[model samples]
Target chain A: MHTLDVALGERSYPIHIGRGLLDDPAPILARLKTPRVALVTNDRVGPLYLERVQHGLERAGVRCTAVVLPDGEAHKDWPTLNLVFDALLGARCERSTTLIALGGGVVGDMAGFAAATYQRGMPFMQMPTTLLSQVDSSVGGKTAINHPLGKNMIGAFYQPRLVIADTATLDTLPDRELKAGVAEVIKYGLIRDAAFFAWLEDNLERILARDPDVLAQAIERSCRNKAEVVAADETERGERALLNLGHTFGHAIETGLGYGEWLHGEAVAAGTVMAARLSRDLGWLGEGDLDRLVALFERAGLPVQGPKLGAERYLELMAHDKKVEDGRLRLVLLDGIGASRVSDAAAPERIAAAIEACCA
Target chain B: MHTLDVALGERSYPIHIGRGLLDDPAPILARLKTPRVALVTNDRVGPLYLERVQHGLERAGVRCTAVVLPDGEAHKDWPTLNLVFDALLGARCERSTTLIALGGGVVGDMAGFAAATYQRGMPFMQMPTTLLSQVDSSVGGKTAINHPLGKNMIGAFYQPRLVIADTATLDTLPDRELKAGVAEVIKYGLIRDAAFFAWLEDNLERILARDPDVLAQAIERSCRNKAEVVAADETERGERALLNLGHTFGHAIETGLGYGEWLHGEAVAAGTVMAARLSRDLGWLGEGDLDRLVALFERAGLPVQGPKLGAERYLELMAHDKKVEDGRLRLVLLDGIGASRVSDAAAPERIAAAIEACCA
Candidate 1:
């Protein structure tokens, strides 16, 4: 088992990564303020692992109320979020009742947001059950729901008390979703960690084959990189924006196609490609660097091209992105394979050409 | 002009109370990150002050987009909140766009919550037009929307960049609304400021008559007391709960009567009486203390008796309050006229009896 702490002062929490970690109640019990919790999951993950997690906590004398939401990113909206609130209020859950999110990114994001706003705020924990969530969403305190204009347009930077990334859950993740998760794993490398990028390149095949050791190593490294960045810039006033490397473009793809059409990781993979192209055009990245970034994503079975949403449409959708400041679009573009910068200086024409060039 | 800073470290902000603070743009301009703003107001307050506030900002070269919502607490819900978001997204408002809430508590709360969630967070300012808002909601970072099940069930503790409490605006406030605002003004004194409570006793008629100096003094004192509490306990962990001395019961009254039926302050006024009764029953307050508290509320033209909602219903509604912990109903009850503490030790029957005694 590996544990990484996100240092956010009083808001700081730990990320525990290992196999079958969910089978234990001690780690989660240590962080809870009370013995009662509202376990928020989805129909898919709920049927598979809800009882196991619930029974474990119940046996340990913790009261658990299960709220099973419909699975998918499309359901990550206001109406869906209200369902969590409805169930919580129905059960008379209080501010001290710990809220445990027990699914992937969508579930974690929605549940975390519910915790952030439920009675002003409540204690929350995450038991991520997907590779994308385990490596990415599990570490960052960014919790939000999708809006018609943009993805994560409405949310909060609320940290969890604990994050348990039980690697065994990945065994049931669909092949496509697992590859999608790799997209974010690669993001850490492109944004800040060069050595981790190289390591991922060397172990891409094994990671794809569900090699526990390799996968665990990737999750740990990704979390470590994320925790450091979050600790330094909790509110994204500076270096933290680098984490959104492909997110601005990725959000456009997600919104442009309508959420749930493309998995978040898949859109992010394609968005990273577009960002790489833009970085190359800006002379920030060498042609070879772009090739290597693309090759790793391609090798991981992730999308290397965005859907055929025209450059103009993509630009329109991207304009609504949270990254836009004072009417200027600020994008996280790679300066090199292991370096990135948030730049609003990219010309619209260059961004458009990059978008056009990367589209299917 | 009187200014009180709610010391919240980095999130600290100034509350400007005066006769015509809204007429000048300098104070607001000093805190704005950008000259662009989305002014959220209700139809009632908008027709009177929106153009004046907008014109003032426009004269200073600030671009303002006005979103007029239906007036009243009935509209302080998710659907009303979405209107603010729709206008923001429609205007392509970015994270830097300052959201100025230009009305009473409902506008301030919904707008503040929108600012807290819009684009993950945006700069927010409060231009509170009601006396109640000026003294209470304007200082605390508590922003929220009412749920059908409970008041402020969904919300955030988002502070504002600046708060402009224009006493001039209160000149146009309705008699009932002005009395409503007085309920909160009296709260600060009852909780921690016995002197302020005595001042209200001496000059209650002058404040109700809209004497500019008396109103300004009342607003300043109320804000000062609120700022001190909020700065010390931002998220209401301990001391801050005392600030909600009447809010849990008040929220029950509001929810029981259907929101907006009894203005928030009116409900709070009656709720405070109930809390005083509960305190007396608990041997925390003498009988004379309860009578004095009731007399002040009555003199202020506020409801001293709650609506005849059955005690069982009030208890049921209060169970869902944010103050509830681990299924135990924790309440802010008075130890005396000027001191209060949150306690769950009051027997359920005692609480029910208090509610029954206080209701008309």
Candidate 2:
């Protein structure tokens, strides 16, 4: 077992990573402020892990109720998010009731948000069951439900009491989701962890093969990087904006294609390639470096090419992203393999060129 | 103008109170982050003051787009909140765009919640047009929408950049609404300031008559007390809970009678009487103190009697309140005429007695 702390002053919390950590569950159980807890999961992941988690909590003398939402990115909307609220309120769950998010990103985001807003707020913990969530979304306090017009357009930065990334849960995860998780894992390295980037390059094969130690290390390092960034800037005020490296482009793709049409990590994977390509166009990144970055995403089974959305359409959609400031779209682009920073160009032509060049 | 600050460390902001405070618009405009602004108001308050606020922002170089919602507590829900999001997103307002909440409590709560969630959040200013909002809800950062099961069941603890409490706007406020605002003003005194409570007693006629100087002093003092408590406990972790002296009983009345049936301040007025009665029953408050509190509500033309929702029903409803810690109903009972504290009684019998006694 490995533990990392996101040092956010009084808001600091621990992220636990290990295989079969759900079996004992002492740490997670001990964190609950209430004897009764609501476990929010989804149909896809619930069947595989719900009973185990319930038994684990029950073993520790805590009462557990489960709310199983339908699985998919599309479910990250208001109506669906309300199911968790209805289940909790219908049960007459008091403010002290702890919400345990027990699925992937969609469930985590919705449950975290439900915990944030339910009765002004309630205590919650994250038990991420997927690679993508374990390494990125689950570690951060950013929680939201998608708006009809945009992805994750409405949400809050409400932190959880604890985050449990039981890597064994990923044993049941699909290959596509596994690869998508690697996209964010690569992101942490690209943003600020050059050593971890080289480590990922060397251990990509073992990671794909599901070597437990290698995967555990991968999760820990990614979380460490993310935790540090979040701790420094809990609300994405300044340095934290660097974490949205490809999200500006990625959100545009997601919103333009309709939320669930493409997986989030898939869009981000493609988006990162575009950011790298843009960096090259601006002469900040060498052609060889851009090629290597695209090759890395391709090797991870991610899409190197973005969908053929027109540059104007992409630009229009990107403007609605949370990153847009003062009418200019600020994007986190790579200056090199392991360096990223936020930049806004006055010239639109270059952005159009990058969008044109990176698409299928 | 009377400007007081809510000293919440870095999150601190100023509350400006007086006649024609909205007309000048310099301080308010300087607080906005972008040239564009989205003004969220309601039908009732919109036709009365929207044009003035829009003109104010425009005069200061802001492009204001208005999204007027239906008025009243009933509209403080998700669908109404979405209207604000739709207006901003449809217009493609960037993240830096500021949301100006230009109405009473309902508008301020929903608009503040909108600002907290829109694009993760945007800068927002509060221009509370109603006395209830100006004295209480707008001064603090507690923004929320109602759920069918409870009042303020869904919301966030998000603060505004600046609060413009234009006492002059109250000139157009309905008599009932103006009296409702006094309930919260009275709350400030009941919880912390005996001097303010005595001042309210001495100047009830002047306040009811809408004497600008007296009302401004009341608003400033009320805001100062609220700002101090909020600064000490921004998230209602400790001392802040004392501010909700009558809120538990008050929210029960509001939720029990249906959201819009009784004005929030009216319910709070009756609730405060109930709290005083409970304090007397508990031997913490003298009979004279209770009489003084009830008489103050009477002079303000606020309801001193709660609707007969039944004791058991009130208990059941309050159990779902944000204050319920591990199933114990925490009530803020008055220690005397000007002192209050949070206490979780083991028995609900006294609360039941108070509810039964205070009801019409």
Candidate 3:
């Protein structure tokens, strides 16, 4: 087992990366000073692992209640988030009662958001069940639920008390979802770690096959990169924006494709390719690097081309993205793998050309 | 103007209390680096003072967009909150955009929560327009919305960049609402400020008349008391619980009666009386002090008795209150006005007796 701590003073928590960490509740439960707990999961994850988590928590002398929400991004809304509070209140959960999120990005985000707002805030542990959640969403303190107006429009920078990424759960994730997770994994490489990208290129098949060792290394590296970024820019005031490399364009795709139709990682996979092309046009990235990025995404069975949303519609949707500032589009562009910068000065023609090329 | 800072290190902000402060947004706006502003208010507050605040912000070169929500406590929910984000997003608000809440407790809490969640949080200024808000809700940074199951079931302790309580807004407030605001004003005295309590007893009438000088003193003292409590315990971890003197019982009343039926202050007024009576029975407070507390509540025209929810139902409702821990009832009992302790060991029979006495 490998542990990386996100140094946030009193808010600091360890990210445990291993094969069966979920079965061991001692460390996670030890961090929680309370005896009562509410386990938040989704239909896709509850039947598979919620019982085991409940058993572990109960054995540790903690009372437990489970709130199983419908599984999907479509269910990540206010009504769904309220179900968590309803379950907590019905069970008479107190502020000291901890929440354990036992699912993928949707569950983690919604459950974390529920914990953030449940009685102002409560300690929660992230037990991410999917690749995307295990590597990216689970490590960052960013918790949110999608608003009808925009994705992740309502949320808070609420960090978890602990993050337990059990590699065993990845066995149950569908192939498409696994590839989706790899999209985020690749994101870290393209934005801030060339060595990690090189490693991913070499071990892509091993990760695809759910090799525990390969998967563990990938998750650990992604979390380490994210933890470092989050520690320095806890609230995304500056350097944290680099983490949104393809998110500006990805959010537009997710919203335009009618969220949940395309997985977040899949949209991001395509968005990153578009962002790389934009970087090439801006002369910040070479054609060879862009080709390698596209090849990697293609090998992972992810899209390297944007959806057929025209430039005008793409601009409209991206305008609603949370990253936009004062009517100006802010794009996270690649200076080179392992480095990134956020800029709104990219000419409209360049952005349009990249959009057209990626869509075509 | 009297300026008292809520000393939370980097999160610290100044609370400016005085008459005619609303006309001067220079100090507050000067601290904010954003030139784009989103003004969040309600229909009632919009026509009354939104123009002046907007003019002030705009005159200072800050582009402002006003989002007017429905008026009253009933509107403090997800739907209304979504409107604020919609307006901000429609205006292309970035993470740097500042949100100015320009109404009462409802607007302040909703807007503050919106700011806390918008793009993981944006700078917000509390331009509290009502007495209840200026003294209590605005100063503490406890932002939330009532859930169908309970009051403040969802929220965060997101502090604002600045709090501008223009005492002049009180002139336009209704008499009932003015009395409601005094309930919180009376709270500071009951929790940990005996001298302040004595001052309220002496100047209750003057404060009701909206006496500029008296009102300013009252607001400043209330904020200073709250700021001190919050600084000592920002997350309501220890000493801060004392500030929730009547909140435990008050939340039960609000939840039992259905939010918006009784104004927050009215419910808190009755809750305070109940808490004092219970404190007296526990031998922590004298009968004379309880009578004095009840008299103050009555003079403010606030409810001194709770609704006819039976003892069993009250217990059930209070159990669901966020304050309850490990199935033990945690009540903030008064040792004396301005001195309180959170005790769960108080006898159930004594609590039942206090409830019976108050209801009778």
Candidate 4:
């Protein structure tokens, strides 16, 4: 197991990455404020591992209750989030009862937010069961639920006490989901780690084949990059904006297509291509660099093109993005294969053209 | 005008307590990151002051939009909160747009929570018109909505950029509400300010008569006490819990009677008497001190006796309080007239007897 700490002063916590970590309760037990916890998962992931985790904690004399929400990003709204609250309140869970999230990004996000708002604030832990969550959403403290008008429109920047990334769980992830996870893995490399980008290019097939060691290494590297960015700019005032390299466009696609139609990483993959195209038009990235970026996403079996939402519709949806400041849309565009920056340099015409060119 | 700063480091903000502070937009303008704002008010308070505040900001060239919600504590729930989010999203309000809450505690809380969660967060300002909000809720940064099971079960500890306590608005406040506000005013004195308690006892009639000078002085002192407690412990780890002296029992009464049935301060007034009775029963407070506390409530036109919900029901409701930890109920008991501490010393039967004794 490899433990990397996200240095956030008093909010700092360790991210544990390894195989079979979920079956072992010591890491979670060590971090819990009390011997009681409420585990939040979704219908998809809960049925698979909830009993094992519950029994494991119970064996150690820790009381555990499970709150299984409906699966999918579409369910990531207030009504679904309230299920967790209803269960906790119904059981009379106190502020000290640690809330453990055991699932993918949607469950983790909803549970983290529930912990953040429930009883003002409560101890939260994340046990991400998918690669997409392990490498990105589960590491950062950004917890949110979608609004009909925009994705992640209502949320909070609440950090978890610990994140348990058990790589063994990835074996159960479907091929499409695994490929979607790689989309975010590629994000770290495109944003800052050029060498990791090359490493992914070389070992994409090994990761696809579910090689345990390679997968763990990739997860650790991605978390290290994210942890550094979060530590430096926890609230996304400046440096952290770079981490949203393709998210501005990606979120538009998700909201435009309706959440869950395309996986988050899949939308990001297509959005990254659009961002690269716009960056190329601005002379920040070369054609060769853009081609390589697209090729890497395609090689991982991810979508490299967005849905057929008109340029105007995409722009309108993107306008509602959290990154929009004073009505100015800030896009994270690639400066090179290994570097990116939040830019307002691209004109509306150029952005529309890029979106049009990259759409299916 | 008295401007006192709540020292919370970067989160610190000034509380402007005086007449007509809301009409003058300079303090709010200076604190805003953008020239845009969304004013959130309730039906009851909107007709009274919404246009004046909006016109003041608009006249100063600040783009202002108004979101008026249904009046009363019953509406302080998710559906009502969604109205604010809907208005903001509909108006395409950016995260930088300042959200000014221009009403009482319900409006302030719903709006503050909206600002805290809208697009992860936005700039929040409090224009507290009611004396209860100005002297208590507006100063503390405790924003929340009530759950069916408990009051403030879902919320956040989000501070505002500036607090404009317009004492002039209190002229329109009803006699009952004015007395309701006094309940919280007396709370600050009972918990930590013996001299202030004595002052309130001597000048209670003047405050009830709405003497501008005495009212402002009372609001300033109440804010000073609350600000100190909040600044020292923003998340309510220790010292801040003392500030919740009567809140546990108070929340129970509020929840038991079905939110809008009684004003929050009225429930708290009755709760305070119950707490003092329990404290005296435990030999922590003298009989005379308890009588004085009840006398002050009676003089303020507040309810000193709670509704006959039965001690068992009150105990059941109080169990769901935020103060409960590890299945143990931590009650804030008075050591004397002006001193309080969180204690687990009272037995359940003793608490029930005290509740029975204090109920109507």
Candidate 5:
């Protein structure tokens, strides 16, 4: 098992990524404050790994209260989140009773948010079972639920006590979902690590083939990159905005098309291309460099073109981005390969051109 | 005007307490990040103060999108909180658009919570009109709404950009509501300031009579005490818990009796008496001191005895307190008159007995 720690001082937590970490109780038992635990998962993963986790906890003398929510991005909303609250309050889970999120991104996001606000706050751990969560959502502490008007419009930046990413769980993941997860993995490379991008260019087939060693390296490297960035700016005061390379455009796509119409990473995949095109229009990237980036996403079987939403609608939706400051949209854009920065200088017409061109 | 700065590092904000703050645009204008503001108030406080605040901001060239929610604690729930979010998204409010809460504690809390989570987070300021808010809620960053299961069971520790406390608005406050606000004013004195408690004893009539200068002094003193405690312990780790002198019991009372049935400060007033009795039962406080405490609440027109909600129900509700650790309830009992500390050692029978005795 490879462990990477996200150094956020008192809010710091370790992310353990490896195959078969789920079958062990030692790490899970170590971080808990009490013997009682509230395990939050979704139907998809609960049916798959719930018994094993429960058995592991129970074997270590921990009591478990399982709350299984409906699975899918569509269910990531306030009403579904209330289900977690209802179960917790119904079971009389105390503030000290650690919440264990044992599923993919949606479950992890919802559970982390629940822990953040339940009785003001509570301790929580993450056990992400999907590649999307394992590599991105589970490590960042950016827990959120979608609002009717925007994706992840409501949430908190509450960190977990521990994160266990069992790559073994990915063995059961659908190919399409695994491809979508690769989108965010590629994001780490696009934003900061050109070597990793070049590395991805060579190893995309092996990574997608679920080569355990290759996948492990990708996850470890991705988390290491994430940990460093998060350590520098835990609250997105400045540098953290660079990590959201495609999210502004991605969020617009997700919100415009209705949440869950496209998996988050798929929207991000297309959005990254839009950002690349905008960067080119801003004279920041070459056409060849942009093609290389799009080629990588295409090779991973991810979308390179966003949905045909009008430029006006894309701008309208993107304007609602949380990163927008003083009525001007702040978007993360590439300066050169492996270098990115947040800028509000892109002209609306140029951004419109990029969106219209990328959609076609 | 008296200003008390809540020194929470970067999240620090100043609480401006005086008459007619709502009519002056300087304080509000100086703190704004953008020209656009989303002003949130309730039906009750809106007609009385919203126009002046809007006019003040508009005169300073700030655009206003007013969202008026239903009045009272019954409205401090998710449905009403969502109305703030809806108005924000409807107005196309950006992350930099400041949310100005223009009412009492409920408005401040809902708006603050909405600002904390809306678009992930946004800038917000507090315009606290009620005495309860000016003296307590507006100074600290504890923002939340009621859950069916608990009061303040869901919230975030999000600080505001500025706080405008208009003592002039108190002229229109109902006598019962003013008395309820006095309960919290008295709480600060009971927890950490014997001199303030003594002063309250000497000046209760003047305060109840709505003397602006005297009320301003009371508000400033209470905010100074709160600002110190919050600055020392931002997340209720230790020193901050002392500030919750009667809040756990108070929350239980509010939740048990149904929210809005008893105003928060009324519940807190009775809960303070119960904590004093518990302190006496635990041999930590003198019976004479407990009597003096109960007498003070009586003199302030607040409840001295808790309602007979049944001892078991109190225990059950208090068990859900955010302070509970390891399934054991951590309660803030008086260390002596003018001092408090959190302890988990109170025997269940003794706590039940305190509840039983205080109810009668």
Candidate 6:
């Protein structure tokens, strides 16, 4: 097992990465001093792993209530978030009551956000059940639900009390979902660690196959990198924006395609490839680098191309993305495989050309 | 002007309390390194004060785009919040854009929450136009919109970069609204400062009359008290909960009555009276203490009795209040005129009697 701490002082929490950790609730529930808890999950994840978490919490002598929300990215909005509050209220949960988010990115984000606002903030534990959540969403403390105007338009940088990432959960994730999680794992390497990227290049298949050891290592490294970035920039003021390497483009795709159609990780995968291509076109990277990114994404069985939304619609969708500023589209482009920078000065024509190339 | 710093490190901001501070934008706009801003106000406050703030910001070389939302607590929900976002996006506001919230608690909370979430948070100034906002809501960064299920069900604690409380704006406020603000001012005295409570008792009429110096001092003292508590417990872990002294009860009143029918301060005014009475019944407070609280609320022309929602219904309403935890009702009872404690052990019979006492 590997551990990383997101240092937010009193809000600080640990990300524990390993296989079979889900069955062990000591680390996650130990921090919750409350006697009662409400485990928030979704229909998809609840039937699979809810019992394991509920049993772990129950064994700890904590009374638990499980709320199963409908599963999907489209459901990650105000209405669904309200359901969380309704369930908590129905259970008569209070300020001291802890909320356990036991699912993928959508569930974690919504549950964490509900915790963040419930009674003006409550302690929550993140037991991420999806590969995507383990590596990215569950670590950063960025909890939010999407708004019709934009994704994650309403949220907070509220840290959880603990994050328990049991690699075994990934064993049941669909192949596409597994590939999606790998996209974020690949992101850490593409943005900050060439060595890790090389490791990913060598172990992509093992990760896809849910090899416990390799998956645990990858989740740990990804969390460590994310934890450091979040600790330094808890609110994504500057350096943290580097973590959104493919997100600006990815958000455009997600929104343009009507959010749930393409999995966030899949869109991010295609977006990363596009970002690398744009970097190459803008003379920031070599063609070989773009090819390497494309090959890695393909090897992970993730998409390397976005929907055929024209440049104008893409621009409109990108404008609504959380990344754009003052209507000047800011793209997080790779300076190389191991570093990234957010730039609004990237020529629109070049970006449009890259989008065209990716779609074509 | 008396200034109090919220001490949230980078998120720390100053609350400037005095007469005519709105005319002086130098200190408030100083934090805005950018040249553009978007001022969010509402119909009631727009024609009265938005232009003055716009002039102040423009004179300070900050281009301003003003968005006027409908006035009322009922309007402080998602649709109204979206208006502010749309105006900013239409104006091509950047992440560095600073939002100036120039209205009462509704506008301040909604705009602050918008700033907190827009582009993953941005700097905003609170130009509180109502007495309630100036004293309480504007000082702490607890911004939110009412969910259909409850008031402030959706929001964040994103502090403002500057809180500009123009005592002058209160002059244009309706008598009832002005009285509502006093409820919060009285709250500070009840929970933490006996001396301030005594002063409020003596000067309630002058404040209601909009006496500039008296109002300024009242605003300054309330803000200072809130700032001290917030600095001690930024996330409401302990002392900060004291700030919600009347809020738990007040939230029930607002939610039970279907929000906006009674101004927030009016509900709080009545709720504080109920809390004081409850404390006395529980032997935590004396008769004189309850009378003093009731006297202060009456002097402010605020409600002393809750709506005639049956005791059973009030209990049902209180049960859903964010303060209730694990089916245990946590009441913030007054230790005296100026001290409070959050206790979940308060007997249900005593609480029921208090609610019954408040029934008309």
lDDT by residue for model 5 (B1-360), tens: 888888888888888888877888898788778899999999998998888889888988999999999998888999999999889988889877889898888999999999988866788899888889888888888999988998887898889989888889899988898999999998888889999998998999999999988898998899899999999999888989887878888898999988899998999998888888889988999888888888888988898878889999999999878888777888888877788888988988988898898885
Model 1 Cα lDDT, one tens digit per residue, A1-360: 999999999888889999999899999898889999899999999999999999999999999999999999999999999999999999989899999999999999999999999999999999999999998887878999988887888999899999999999999999999999999999999999999999999999999999999999999999899999999998889999998888888988999888999999999999999999999998889999999999999998888999999999989999898878878899998889899999898988999999999988
Q: Write the per-residue lDDT of candidate 1 for residues B5-51, one digit (tens) a residue.
A: 98999988888888878889999888889889999999999999999
Q: What ordering of candidates by DockQ runs from best to worst?
A: 4, 1, 3, 2, 5, 6
Q: Which wins on DockQ, candidate 1 or candidate 2?
A: 1
**Cα shift from native, residue B16, model 3 (Å):** 1.2
* Candidate models: Cα lDDT each: 0.92, 0.88, 0.88, 0.94, 0.89, 0.84
lDDT of 5 by residue, A1-360 (tens): 998999999888899999999999898788888898999999889999999999988988998999999999899999998899889888888878899999999999999999988877889899998888998889878989988888888898888989999999999999999999999999999899999999999999999999999999998988898889988998788988888888889989988988889998899999999999999999998888898999999999999999998999999998778887777888899977798989999988989999999996
Cα lDDT tens digits for candidate 2, B246-285: 8889999999989999999998999889888988998899
Give the candidate number with the greatest DockQ: 4
Tens digits of per-residue lDDT for model 6, B1-360: 777788887778877777787788788666885777888988988998888878987887788888999989889887788788778767667678888898888998899888887766778888888888888888878888887667887677888888888787887888888888888888899998999989988998899888888988988888888888888888776878888877777888888888789999888888888888888888889888888788778767788998888777777777777666557888889879787999987777778899889868
Local error of candidate 2 at A350, Å? 2.1
The worst-scoring run of ten residues by lDDT in candidate 3 chain B lies at B351-360
Instruction: Return the lDDT, model 4, position A355.
Output: 96
Superposed on the true interface residues, model 3 gives a C-alpha RMSD in angstroms of 1.4
What does the lDDT read for residue B155 in candidate 6? 73
* Cα displacement (Å) at residue A21, model 2: 0.6
Candidate 4: docking tier? high
lDDT of 3 by residue, B1-360 (tens): 889999999999999988899899788678886698889999999999999999988888989889999998778788888888878877778888888899999999999999988978998899999999989999878999888777887889999999999899999999989998999999999988999999889999999888899988999999989999999999887888887777777777888877788888988888888889888988899878888889988887889998878777777777777777777888989988778889896776777778777874
Q: Which portions of model 1 miss their true places by more than 4 Å?
A: none
Candidate RMSDs in order: 1.1, 1.7, 1.5, 0.8, 1.8, 2.5
- Model 5 native-contact share: 0.87
Quality of model 4 by C-alpha lDDT:
0.94
